[model samples]
Target: MKTTIPVAVAFVAGVVLVVSFFFDEGTWVGGISQEFKIWMTIVGGFTILLGAVSITRVNWSAVQRKKEGWPYKLLTLISIFVMAIPSVLPNTWSPLFGRDVGSIYDWLFTYLDSPMMATMFATLAFYIASAAYRAFRARTAESTVLLVTATVVMLWRVPMGEAFLNMFPGDIPNWLNTYVMNGANLAVQRGIIIGAALGAASMSLRIILGIERTYMGKG
Candidate 1:
């Protein structure tokens, strides 16, 4: 009964949203659906405190265990408290002591967090390029066609690409991308969209009738 109510509500709302596009008269349903989403978001924000508490508990326990990078854990706790405590009780903003705690939090995210994520992604670029190079090698005629098409499109994506394409008679890459690659990409994307929509619809139907028991957890 606990899981049933929320799941039923979600399924009904999802179906209504899917149908709302086809019927102008059902626009009121869309407004109500959006309002429900806003309420859910507010409730979810409050519920997230539970997650914050859990994270703190787990990280603190790791530090107590004398795990590696315990110093980093200490810094994380400091950062959380620095942001949370200030935001809780109001205070003045200062560039010296640190502007708004929110601003400091934003700075931390934009600078420290974003750079770490970017560096990790930069590290993966070499490996991705190596993998693509290995995969692009063709053995069969069908493979050759796919490889050539992919190569043409890839070269056209850049400025120096024209240097490579100059080997061809005319604007071969532009013609291929505009006429050939564009059509193939669109067709493949549409097929994927249709398959995804059908899959979602089937799964949603099962959920609505309670065939999907995974959401029930223990019971």
Candidate 2:
């Protein structure tokens, strides 16, 4: 009974939204769809609050238990509060406490957060390069083709690639990279997107029909 009501509401909402897209803008169905979209945004904000509450509860519990990595969790909790408190302060109080430009939260975000993000991305680049080196093997025909194409694309983007290619008469590498990326790669990307959309539609239909009971906490 608990799951049935929510499932019915979801099914009706989904059908209304799908139909609204095809209906005229001035129609009642379209108006209802617009209202539903506004409700979705409100629900999204509440979901963020729920997520914050869940994270705080878990981190506080870990800190209380003195669990492994509790120090990090505590730091995370402190950081969240530090970042949030300033934003919630009154505009009048914010300027008095230097919470506008050189404020604690702003400084931390600018100097600390920015550097941390850059460092993380730099670290990820190394990991990506390592993964690429391991994966780019010429074991099969497909792998050979992929490795060659990737090599050409990477080289064509750099000055050295252009320099090397310039030595050989025609602009073969440039043409190959441009055509493969814009033509072949784009077509594959479109195919993947279409497949994903179809898969999502199938899943949505299953949920609407009550065939996907997994969403209702049932295996």
Candidate 3:
């Protein structure tokens, strides 16, 4: 009954959403589709609450057991409440209570969270460079072409690299930007987008028809 109900709901929702696009916003199907979207947003809010509860339980359990790295888990729990509690309170209570500008939430996100994220991404740049080095080895014909193209693209991005390309005569930078980026790259991207769209459409159809039952958690 659980599986049957979810599948039926999914089918109806999918059909209504798809059919809604063909009709005007004032129509019955369109209204239902809009209502479904609002329901999805409400579900998303509940999902966030569920996630917070799940994380708190896991971290609190780890801390209670005195597991290795329990301090980090405790810190995570503290950070969650410290950030969340203020944001939910009334803005009139204090200047730092709500999520508005200059509030605790805004300050933490802008200063602490943003810098931490930037530092993490900066650390990842080295790993990306290492991967690029391994992938750009010119042992095969395809790899050699890829290596050359990557070199050109990288060079075209920087001032010194653009200067080096200009040393080779015949407007190398212009040619690369015109043919390689705007022409070849754009064409390949469009082809990939079309292929992905078709794949998504097929998957959606399978889900709507109840053929994709894996989402029910027991296939």
CA-lDDT, candidates in order: 0.76, 0.85, 0.94
User: Candidates 1 and 3: which is better by TM-score?
Assistant: 3
Which pairs clash (backbone N, Cα, C closer than 3 Å) in model 3? none
TM-score of each: 0.72, 0.88, 0.93
Error of 3 at 217 (Å): 0.4
lDDT by residue (tens digit), candidate 3, 17-63 = 89999999998888988999999999999999999999999999999
**Model 1: ten consecutive residues of lowest lDDT:** 90-99
The lDDT-based order of candidates, best leading, equals 3, 2, 1
Local accuracy of candidate 2 as per-residue lDDT tens digits, 71-138: 99999999988887785676576552335677776787789988999999899889989998787689
Question: Model 1 over residues 115-178: C-alpha lDDT tens digits?
Answer: 9989999989899899987876789999899888877777887778867886889777778777
Clashing pairs in 2: none
Relative to the unseen true structure, what is the C-alpha lDDT of residue 40 in candidate 1, on a scale of 0 to 100? 76
Which structure is stronger by TM-score: 2 or 3?
3
